[model samples]
Target chain A: MRPALLFPLLGLTVALLFAGSLLTGPAAIGLGDSLAALFRGEGEAVVLVMREIRLPRALLGLMVGAALGASGAAMQGLLRNPLAEPGLIGTSAAAALGAVIALQTGLAAAFPPALPLLALAGAVVSVLAILGLAGPRGGSLTLILAGIAISALAAAFTALVLSLSPNPFAASEIVFWMMGSLADRSMLHVWIALPAMLAGALLLAGTGRGLDALTLGEDAAATLGLPVARLRLAVVLGVAALVGAATAVAGAVGFVGLVVPHLLRRAVGARPARLVPAAALGGAAVVLAADIAVRLIAPDRDLKLGVLTALVGAPFFLHLILKSRGERP
Target chain B: MTLLALDRLSVTRAGRPVLEGATLTIGAGEVVGLIGPNGAGKTTLLRAALGLIPAKGHASLAALPPARRARAAAFLPQQRDIAWPMPVAAVVALGRVAHAGSAGPADRAAVERALAAMGLADLAARPATELSGGEQARVLIARVLAQEAPLILADEPVAGLDPAQQIATMQVFAAHAAAGGAVLASLHDLGLAARHCTRLVMMQAGRIVADGPPAAVLTGAHLARVFGIRAQLSEGPDGPLFQTLGLL
Candidate 1:
């Protein structure tokens, strides 16, 4: 497909999925009624459900999904590896660790913004650590190895925190938070994460040209006048803010970032620059669809969004591995 | 006028010197072949000249601002890595990255011209990674050509090409020089260097052991002393013919 047509198609799909997300739930809210309540604030119960509950859910899904998708694409482009994702750099794991701390200490229940704030802090620390570990001229191998070590450490610490929690209630809360969800979010959640996500998305967007140059390799890109150090900084900070804000709002959602970019890369002609926006749109659509499916598949049970994404994404990941193996000589 | 000048440039890697006090100047309309045995700092010199690595002393091109430096000189590294399977055209278009937001008709024309120059016009839509090694090398060379810089630094740009393709690639560099650009290419093929390069600079043990015209620099004594090889030099119809007799 031509690059011009690809964006609009992805945008329309995301819009349709957004609408689908808003219309789904236990209540029998008709599409027309939901649209009316969403736009015109008609009918008391309809307005309450649409405004206070479903609207926030759909908005979070779009924002968080877009963040993960764009971050994933940027990560892959920077590392020049197709399998790279937001989680690879330890941002998601570190953010999850922060949120787990908030839950275990009962700070999240006491204060609403404390969860995301701490999570963002964790992401910032992880970015700093990775940058410090991988020096200015460190190659991709060094960066990847550093990220793996940081991720493993964060995961271990998070597990330790959960195991040592004072009560089973706190442990369960931490477990549920780690499972990832979009339930009971408010406009406050949207307002808190929106600015960081926007800033991160802007940073990632500016790296398109640099990322394109990087296809030639780092030395060639540097010689092409790309300040490779600055590019790395921007990508790291941008991904940190995005995945941090995302995990803060919706727990530790996985696979959307890793899966969406891989799926849309071919459609974008495998150009890293074009894949950024396409993956963002595709991510939003996938997350919204998954969120909707979660509601319909098991309405009585509180089905987690991360669980469903893993259920779908893990198989796709395996298939990609097998396909790659088959193509190898 | 000198398009590139290196004044006593020196580089040390892992606490060991790789290039020591290497002074050279490449004038416009000259193709200077950097010839040296393995670990003789040919690659290091090109990299340091392009500011890809840290070194002592000064490289004139490295002193310019990054974008201005990029516009002034295009570099092709020793490694030809195409990480993604992007189309040939898209990969070649990456040369215009430094000129971002300024691309217009001229940039498109340059890309088309480069593709044609490297005989890649027919494979413009093919995935770059799917191409053969020689084809991929040509594509990368096309990418450098599209940069349209006044100076070009290429490290082993024609290493994997067939004999015909190798000559054609050298001719492309010669043509670039004839069009008022300066090219400093590191080469291992003594014969190609003797035939195509306007001048030759031979290095040994992190220093330039000889620098002059090919006929003056690639003599039997220098070959035996620097490369530890006995070479027979004779004049062929086209240019100087170099034949390695045996290891000294």
Candidate 2:
């Protein structure tokens, strides 16, 4: 488990899953034919399935998963809490609220980008609120408390929006959207989220050194010349842009951010810097695998990506809590 | 040469002043012990001096740019926190974060030297969080040592250590000073301070009550007035030893 080797291994896993995602749909296109259609765009039906249908879905899976994973790693590093994630600070919940608003008002159906745009707006508002409430130099406890308050408010508002939906179909749409999916995403969806995800990933990647210094505690890290305030800003904005754009497109995908980093931390020797790229790749792989599982496990029923991840991740979360408790004096 | 200078530095926390117009200077090749009671602002002064918090006056090192300030002084906080179970070597290597892109053989050598200095060579591969409190303290000390800054500010760096480890840790600070660096350490062990520190600054009620050589500052009158304690002072083979007799 040398750090150098871990990256390539994770990369291979992601590639395999990406390919698996492309080949695992209901059409049963051969791997060689799908690969050829993906590259050459020669056959009409194969090209239609590979290029128009599966490519965007698989690509979105990679981007969203990478975003969640990297954001999760950065959040954990900043808070110095293993359980910390993008959702803990209300980014995902706020995004879900935004998407729910779009669905409730029927704007998402009318305008293609409204859902993602409104979701990103929600994420931005929640992040701004957290920063405003916590202030620049507020300690971790204050930040977490603010996040909790924002999350509760967002969750309440979302439920209210759902309860007051004009029609039962809108309510169902809202509920299904909250469950999260990579279904029916097109190239337009990829284009919408790619820039924000890239920006967020770059910002999170830049925080490696600051995050490493934070292991010594905030005071010590500050004394070590880490621009702690700036670091917090970068992480918050990064997670907001990432999780926001993700929720905009895929609805409220959960657990990939929280679980991926936890799984890869030991492989990177618990170094936050090393975990960033590793978690990014691992996240993409997890999402792709989960998306594939959703397709295969319930082919006829649209099994949501978030549901599968939560099903797997919730038990893992419990196991971690139990292990942590056992380790405590 | 003066490595660190604080002029009229004051700090107020929660509407109450914790350090009031405290001024001190540390010269290269000096191990200065900051001795005070629980709420006497020793930790506050160190924190302000390192620019970890806002202060009324000025700290010369704190005025520098963050990168330069980090290169100039290394700080060890009162709390020993290693957030993750990172390997000991990796934790020690974190000291070079400020010196990023320049971590050549010299940085590795310095880290290795620090590990050896703190008797952590054998445990370099072990998880830092899994170690005992004393071992963790030493590991953090090793991190500071690897920082190789000209000035060091340590808040209770030797607390929870065994007697031998405490002496050994103090000797490391003394050695750092002897090598032309400067150290200002907040310590509760009066005996160790008297033996190892080149000078002592004693604070009471958010102010420096005494500042001089240990023998001049830790006298019976100052002890009674500042600490509200009676002490019996005697000269041991290693240095001046004082025993607390009773509360005054």
Candidate 3:
């Protein structure tokens, strides 16, 4: 698809899925009632449900999906690897560990913003570590290896936090958190995640030209007058912020980054800079659609968002690996 | 005008000198070919001169700011890398990155001119990754051309090209020089270097052994000592023809 057509189509799809997410809930609220209560605040109970519950969920979906998608595109562009995403590179996992630490240590309970803030801190640390381990001129393989190591270490620490917890209820909540969901979230979560996500988007947005030049590899990009070091720094900080915020608010929503960019790469003609915005919209659509599916699949039981995304994304990941293998000698 | 000036440039890798005390200057309307045996510091010299790597000596281009450096000199690496399947035109348009803003008329014209020069006008809309290896080499060369910098530093620019394309590429570099620019290309093909370049700088083991006009630099002694090759050098109708007969 031409960019002119692709952007609008993706925007429309996101809008429809946003509506679907808002409308599809276990409360049995009608579409008209939901919209009226959401915007006009008409019905008392319905207004509470719409404004307090559904609206924030939908908004978080858009924000988280956009962050993941944009970060994924930026990562792929910087590293010149399609498989490079926040989750695979340990950004999300490190963020999750941060959130876990905040929860278990009662920091989140003491302060409302500590959850996402700590997660952002965690992301920054992990990203810095990845950069250090990967080195300045690290290859794709070195990056991935470093990421795998960081991810394992972070995941182990998170599990250690869970095991060392005295409160079994908090432990159970941590387990549920690990599964990831949008249930019972309020406007507070949205406000908490918003600033970091916006900051990340702003940073990643400036990297398009650099990423485009990087398609010719780092040495050529440097010769083309791009500040390659600055580009890497921005990408690192941006990915950390975005992934940390999203993981803090919505546990670990896996594969939205990987799957969305892969789906939209062709639509955007495989240009990394062009892929960022397109993938952002496409990611929002995919997540909203999946969020709606989770609600529809088990209206009463609360099906986790990660479960749905992984169900769809894991097979897609396999397909990508097989396809790439076929393409190689 | 001197487009590039390097004074006693030196590069060390892992505490060992890879390029040592290489001083050369390239002026406008000059196509200077850098020829040497493998690992003889030709690549290191070009990189050090362009300020792509940290080096010990002064390089005029290296002294400028990155943005100004890009406007002054464009470099083409030995490796041909097109990470995505972007259209050939899009890949070429990336050359205008340093110019800022979207692709304006001037940028578009430069891209079109580069495409036509490299005979890739028809492949403009095609995915660059889908082309044959030689065609991809041409596209990369076109991208370098699209940069429109006054000085071009190309490492093995014609390595993968066919004979005719190689000649055409050398002609393109020559044309760039004729248009008041300069090109310093590292090449292994001594014949092409001898015939097309206005001057040749030959290196042996981290040092320049000779630097002058092609006829003066491509001496039998330089060939034997630097490249370890016994070559026959004769004057063809077009220019000097250098043919390697056996190892020294």
lDDT of 2 by residue, B1-248 (tens): 99998999999999999999998988999999999899999998998888888889989987998989889999999899999999999999989887867469988999999999999999999999999999999999999998899999999999999999999999999899999998999999888888889999999989998999999999999998888988877888868887878898
- Best DockQ among the predictions, by candidate number: 2
Candidate 3 has a TM-score of: 0.96
Q: lDDT per residue, candidate 1, B1-248, as tens digits?
A: 79998999999989999999999999999999999999999999998888888899999988988999989999999899998889999899888886766368889999999999999999999999989999999999999999989999999988999999999999999999999998999999998999999999999989999999999999988998999999887898868898888898
Deviation of model 2 at A128, angstroms: 2.5
| Predicted candidate 1 versus true structure: per-residue lDDT over A185-293, tens digit per residue | 9998999889889889888988988888899999899988999989987888888889989998998888999999999887888989898888989999989999999
Residues forming the 10-long window of minimal summed lDDT in candidate 1 chain A = A135-144
Off by over 4 Å in 2: A324-329
Clash totals, every prediction: 0, 0, 0
The share of true interface contacts that also appear in candidate 2 amounts to: 0.86
Each model's C-alpha lDDT?
0.90, 0.91, 0.89
Candidate with the larger lDDT of 1 and 3: 1
Model 3 gets an lDDT of 0.89
Per-residue C-alpha lDDT of model 3 across residues A84-119, encoded as one tens digit per residue: 887766888898898888889888889967877788
Candidate 1's iRMSD:
0.8
In angstroms, the error of model 2 at B61 is: 1.5
lDDT of model 2 at residue A134? 88
